[model samples]
Target: MLSTKVAADTTPSTRNYDDNVAVDTKKKVDRARGNITQRRCLIDNIWNAHVVDYAHVYEADGKKDGLISKLERSWNVKSGTLNSNTRRNIFRLSAKLHRLFDEEKWLLLPETKIVDQYYEHYREAGYADEFPVIKDLSFNYTLVAHPDMRQVAIHRRVEGVDINTPGAFKTFIYPFDTFPVIVSHVHPCFVICNSGQKLKDYDKIVAFRKGDTDQRKKRIARIQSFSKRLDGW
Candidate 1:
């Protein structure tokens, strides 16, 4: 009789409130599990939506090797091989091509397996490494009031560098036209634009461009010519 009573108590129709709660909890757990699986699938698709392999393209092209060799020669020209001005022109042209690739969004973020590889390449080898994935770059400048009556304080931080430092951090400030030279020290695959001008109210950066002195002069000339033409109209 005890065995029969135990079987009757174990049946669903004879269950208590605790048993109903347990069943509802199990259903919620199953739904949460399903949601997590679906989210992972969606994230995977987004992460790999635009994977580009630049090295593979360069390898597939038959003349890539010769072209790279020529550029390197131009970059490393000795005192007698090419005049200093000519060498500078070559360097500028090469830099312009790199800046164009970055500005035009030709390079896309690589896959996870190779992303670290490209980062290491850029960090160690500078701009001459395999083409790096380009992303928007910006700087942060913070201003705070000093305890003294007459003075204010300014602090600056570049986009990629670390924030934590023990002592006074030195920052290099250059004219807007020299921005490209400043960035070339970090990497050639970057361009400075005024996208943040309206957001930050950065008046000085209104005419900044990623080019050398000559390029900056040409840009100024074009702007002046346009202004004059408009006035004549």
Candidate 2:
């Protein structure tokens, strides 16, 4: 899971993107539309939109590291959202939205309060046990700072873990792309957690429909091509 906290800064400068950059990014998107997924398109838009700075915090040899190292190491998913692909997508979308909002400076102080209330409600409802780490889960409110200084982006990585394997540490959260912009008040543009978790074995039921190895390879190739095109933009 991911969240962004936006605060006012004393800096007077603002970042802007060139019109040509957006035009070129759209061209790349159009070229890849025949072969890529909507998710990939969303990623492309986020990447070319602005300059983003990222920071990661995770456990290394039993020690915490990154901007959020002091926070708890364990994370819990809602009872049913544990499927590898589903979880991965949630992480990706959350990071993407964070970057998009940052780029536009459409961040509201109330949004941070809403995120805080969410966790408080979860704990008061006796859902802490659902995520074992919640008992010790404490957020460093001081970590929330002006985006210009440290554009906060966090992902909890488990060292030596294979992301493809179920229950692996890396599977807890995935890294995502971002862009930069100034901070300003805006109404909430998106909401998280509307999607429900799976109650059954997601992999066993969905794997068959995903296609064969050759098809998978082609999809990967297309994504790589799209990424390369964006690099040029």
| lDDT tens digits by residue: candidate 2, 1-233 | 33222211211123222221233333433343222222222222222224322201110121112211211211333332221111111111234444443432212111234344444534365322333222211121111122332343433333356656663432111112123121211111111111101101344213221332444223323323322322232
Query: How much is the lDDT of residue 193 in candidate 2?
Result: 18
lDDT of 1 by residue, 142-205 (tens): 1111122122111223333454653333332322221211211111111111111111222322
TM-score per candidate, chains pooled: 0.20, 0.20
Ten residues in sequence with the least summed lDDT for candidate 2: 190-199
lDDT of 2: 0.25
In candidate 2, list every pair of residues with a backbone clash: 80-198
Cα lDDT for residue 159, model 2? 33
> Which candidate number would show the highest lDDT if scored against the true structure?
2
Q: Give all candidates' CA lDDT scores.
A: 0.24, 0.25
